[model samples]
Target chain A: MSAVKQFIPLFDRILVSRAVAAAKTKGGIMLPESSQKKLNEGVVVSCGPGAVDADGDVIPVSVSVGDKVLLPEYGGTKLNLDDEEYLLIRDSEILGKFVKVTSE
Target chain B: MSAVKQFIPLFDRILVSRAVAAAKTKGGIMLPESSQKKLNEGVVVSCGPGAVDADGDVIPVSVSVGDKVLLPEYGGTKLNLDDEEYLLIRDSEILGKFVKVTSE
Candidate 1:
């Protein structure tokens, strides 16, 4: 019933929604969109069944849906649906998971 | 005893040696080094123990040493040792395995 459920990833693949553009400077000065370096941050939307082993067994991936992860600058297939863009990256392409730090 | 044994990759990392430059035209005219586009082909020298799970079990990688593979155009840690340069890429960065085809 949701756009997120429209597609299913396969073979250790992960669907991610990219975060908003960076480059919010200290002052009110706004630089052109092309001049700013894009960050590799995103939130996982969906995941595949995981990679297969030598014996044909599926090994589960480390990250899951809703997990915020750091993506590589390059690679990953681009997907466009319903006027929205998404990225399909492999499980190994995920640099690291971003965990929120709450005030203790 | 070989230079390949000098470094051992960790996690899903893989050590690769880039293939030679392309652009050797059929006419045998040599193009300048700067004009040639580099292919993402390489031989796997070594690989890490593979990714771990929540329970901390090591999942064996799909590829092995001595396999010819397609490398990504970017996002690899470069390593230079004893004159030869190598790359440290993740297992997922490998596009696919390259197999030689012979005339039957």
Candidate 2:
């Protein structure tokens, strides 16, 4: 969070860190980087002020910090910050927020 | 516009027709299909009702019908309808509206 704070998103944009593949398999065998699949899931790092309308009213974005979101297969602007890979995407490009399923 | 109405967008989504490269160059030299570069510019054909907030409030989108917009280099769901290619992309992925300058 500290590192992501240095860069802020603007104009209904969001910064996200894509998820990495599992380190080990079900058999507890370590996997190689080449075998790791690039995940479309990401964690919301930061968000910009919501986009303004014709009348100049600011609308709040649906997502917030710490929310997990489903990303479009393509379309994010790749950026490297603090040696970490991040994406600058407009909130509209986000497919949906991954809802956490909590058992009763 | 008649054909685009067959499909409707949802949640800040917009339908756009990507610009096609000219068959002839400024010098009047005809170019082959292989030489055509996919343009990132598009014209807004249709748009979804604005995304609703958690409070269920609908926000109006910035761009309207007939607006020209700059699209991300990559990212948009491609669909073919009535022999025409269109993209379904969130309005956020749109870089900006192409403003027309009228000379007095």
For every candidate, what is the interface RMSD in angstroms? 16.1, 15.7
Q: Residues B11-69, candidate 2, lDDT per residue (tens digit)?
A: 88999998987999989999999978877777899899977766677766667889877
| TM-score value, chain A, candidate 2 | 0.88
Backbone clashes under 3 angstroms, per model: 0, 0
Query: Candidate 2 on A1-104: residue-level lDDT in tens?
Result: 12212555546878899998788998999999898987899999888777776554787888999999999999978866557998878889999998778998
What lDDT would candidate 2 get against the real structure? 0.80
Best by lDDT: 2
Per-residue lDDT of A65-87 in model 1, one digit per residue for the tens?
Answer: 99999998898977664568888
Tens-digit per-residue lDDT, B1-104, candidate 1: 65554788999899998887756676888878886755567789999998876667787766789987766567899899778989899886665554444443
Q: Which stretches of candidate 1 lie over 4 Å from their true place?
A: A1-104, B1-5, B101-104
What are the runs in model 2 whose C-alpha is more than 4 Å off? A1-104, B1-5
Pairing residues by index, what is the TM-score of model 2?
Answer: 0.51
Query: CAPRI band of model 2?
Result: incorrect
DockQ of each: 0.02, 0.02
